[model samples]
Target chain A: MNIWLLIVGVGLVSLCLRASFLVLLRGRQLPERVTSSLGLVPAAVLAALIAPELLYSSVTGTLDVLNPRLVIGLLAAAVAWRTRNVLWTLMVGLGLLLVAQGLGWR
Target chain B: MRHPEDMTEIIPHSPQFRPAFWRGMRAFTPLVPGVVPFSMVAGIAAVQAGFTPAESIAFSLIGYAGSAQLIASQMVTSHAPTVLIVLSSLIVNLRFAMYSASLLPLFVGVPLPRRWLLAYGLTDQAYAVTMGRPVTEPSPAAYYAGAAALMWLTWQSGTAVGALVGAKIPSTWPLDFAVPLSFIALLVPVLQRRPQVFAAIVSAVVAVAAHGLPFRLNLILGAVCGVAVGQLMQRWQAKSV
Candidate 1:
């Protein structure tokens, strides 16, 4: 498929998926199971994205339990959970990663 | 007579929505550190995937999503089957459907046209900033417009700039770390309940185990497994109680 065509197709699919419930289910009660599941979607999706990012080395496709990213990611998660402050999380997380790299720790 | 549109009863007047809109916009500001790099990554990745700058912009604007854009272009570059590309991108974006459902309770009073625009602009930042907000705070329509509009603008502009100069960014700079870090910051706060915590743990485990799945199907699988497991946990909790 042409790249432009592909872009459009992706656009249509994304918009349709996004607007599905918002448009279709107006004034209607959602299923009980779905309602609760939706609450978990954000956490679930983020975890799904974050786990691969923090645990796997995309370049080598190997698990890196001791990678700098894993270390700093844990630190960031702790700071985020405790402080609940984005600024601190960024300052501390990025700061630690940079510091680790500077100290010659991979 | 009460209008059906006023189900949430928050948006009784357009005048009241104006401030709410600005508040929503400002609410999304704190997320810039997270979102800007993500879009930049998407833009740069698109160009590296052998797309023309124009086409890259088209994908960014049309796709209007960071992860999906990156995933779609990467799939294209790998000559992955079109069906797989579509499935992968759809899976990546499936959370937006849940976003719509979350916005519904908050946005019950918004009109159809505005809601459509809000839906179009919904992203992780928008959803995170606006979800579960008190009904008395502001009109969801206004706040969502402010937040999602600014976020959409940042994402589109960031992609455009990233496409032009993303190739120059060194891979060693640890820019990608910002994404996981930002997500950590976002995810940590939302994990207030046991079900949420358990769901995240299950998803993390599933995601890592399924990391080798084709076309990043592991993400979709992890998400599905997380939700199912979370629901089951909730059920178990209720049963035990």
Candidate 2:
């Protein structure tokens, strides 16, 4: 699969998904349940990606809290929960990690 | 409750291009403060992964998704086959399909050319903001256009800056964590109910459990499982009520 081919293929598939309802539901009302379920997609997918990276050092590998990346992520999550601000979360989490590294904590 | 006519009257008349464009720019302001650091990391990653400035900018503009671009760069560095690299990037971006589907209801009446532009401009940030709004009239396309254009410009500019200046930024600055933190920032605001919470928990568990699956299939599997769990829970709740 050429990279360009892949991009074009994925782009088409993505466009299809986006355009499906518009094509299918033209001149019709979407069922309420179906419409509501689409709402779950983002939160579900983001959690799937975020959880493992934040909680574990590696998939199918031993847990390692000592990993500086893991510590940094945990701190980021905490800041995110507290402040709910993107910049602040990044700054605080990354700041702590760098400081910890400076002190040779890892 | 007010009738549909009343609701229609409540919508302010759609603004012209100047106001719409400025509104789009204003929507992007919150994102500006965060992009410099994030794109700098992306830029350095692309450069270290052997991408030229043009290629890096192209990925930022065309690929559009930061994480996907980073992963693609990594795959490129590792000599992964073109198919595998593209498939992996596509898998990561599968979520966008869902975003587009959810937003389609709001923009059904917009013209095709406008829809094409909005599709090109769609980003996670833009979708987050757009989906959170109650559906308003006078063209949901305008609101989406405003938000998406702003995010697109900011993202491209940030990538350009990163490609130019990323090398000067020290690794000691803790930029690596910014990417995940950005997701966290996006995540917190969207966790609106029990079903969403359950979906997140299930997705996380499935992601961990299925992590060893080949081609990062775990992500796809986990997302499906999470969505299923959420839908099931919603159904059960409806029955109970």
Candidate 3:
């Protein structure tokens, strides 16, 4: 239960996972299908993280359309689609959220 | 095969240290804006969550992943058991395992010691840039080192600044939006194919459905489900083609 122990344990597990393929597939070429499938990891994981944050107000909590975070997040998504730039998308989302707040939308 | 000594000697050096460093900096240029706000917010959150400046900097340097650090800090604040916190954090970061696997092929020929460094430096930004790159003569170690080092330095500095100045910055600014915005931007570019889109949509839905699950187990489940679906879709497409 010690925090240091926990950190060390997690760190070791992460390292092992990271090193798994390197050790197992050392001299072998991964099949093309397997290689292509690895691309799913990021999108899958990111969506998993982002979804609840945008859709729900709290953990295990009710969905609230009035949630400012969700509204602002949608604005951010729109910006991401339009500009396709992280910096610009962030700026526009933040700008819109602040504007909405100033207009008493929050 | 040629001698290892000869190979090392033959590898061309950059023209100068200044340019090499500048090139490294330029490689990081694309990521600065994204890294800055996220790190700054992380810094401020660390302080607000009661971490000392030194601790905040240490987390930025060592923890590396902003989301994981944030989750860990939240657990700490709520007095969650250490094991639970670490377990959840591990689950959240499990995707890095896949990333490292995908990149291992690229780093195969690099020396053991340098490869170790790249392993430590493997990050979201570094992985994003390096994947799909077609270098006529790939030096994965050097490229990864350049990108990771720059990201590490920038993230640490930004966290420090944010911890120092974030309190003075007003809450009126929508700084919180930056993190999600950053992810959205990263997401759009990667959604170029049907399988990826399918995976993303399914993952989002599963995550939302499983959001209430205890110990953040839903994240792991959602990720696995998504990967399975994407792989199935990939197989189907391949067969049809």
Candidate closest to the true structure, highest lDDT: 1
| Model 3: interface root-mean-square deviation in Å | 3.0
What TM-score between 0 and 1 does chain B of candidate 3 receive? 0.75
TM-score of 3: 0.79
Rank by lDDT (best first):
1, 3, 2
- What is the C-alpha DockQ of each candidate? 0.54, 0.48, 0.51
lDDT of 3 by residue, B1-241 (tens): 2225323411236333344334544666777777777778778766665677767776666566766666666556656666777776666566676777777656555555445555666667776666634464345445556677888788889889978876666765656556566667767777889988899889888988887677666666787788789999989998999
Top candidate when judged by DockQ against the true structure: 1
Candidate achieving higher DockQ, 2 or 3:
3
Candidate rank order under DockQ:
1, 3, 2
Fnat per model, in the order given? 0.68, 0.52, 0.56
What TM-score would each prediction reach against the true structure?
0.78, 0.76, 0.79
The runs of at least 3 residues in candidate 1 whose Cα sits more than 4 Å from the true structure, single-residue gaps closed, are: A1-6, A58-60, A82-106, B1-20, B26-34, B70-80, B105-111, B131-139, B171-179
**Which stretch of 10 consecutive residues in model 3 chain B shows the poorest summed lDDT?**
B1-10
Pairs in clash, predicted candidate 3 = none
TM-score of chain B of each: 0.76, 0.72, 0.75
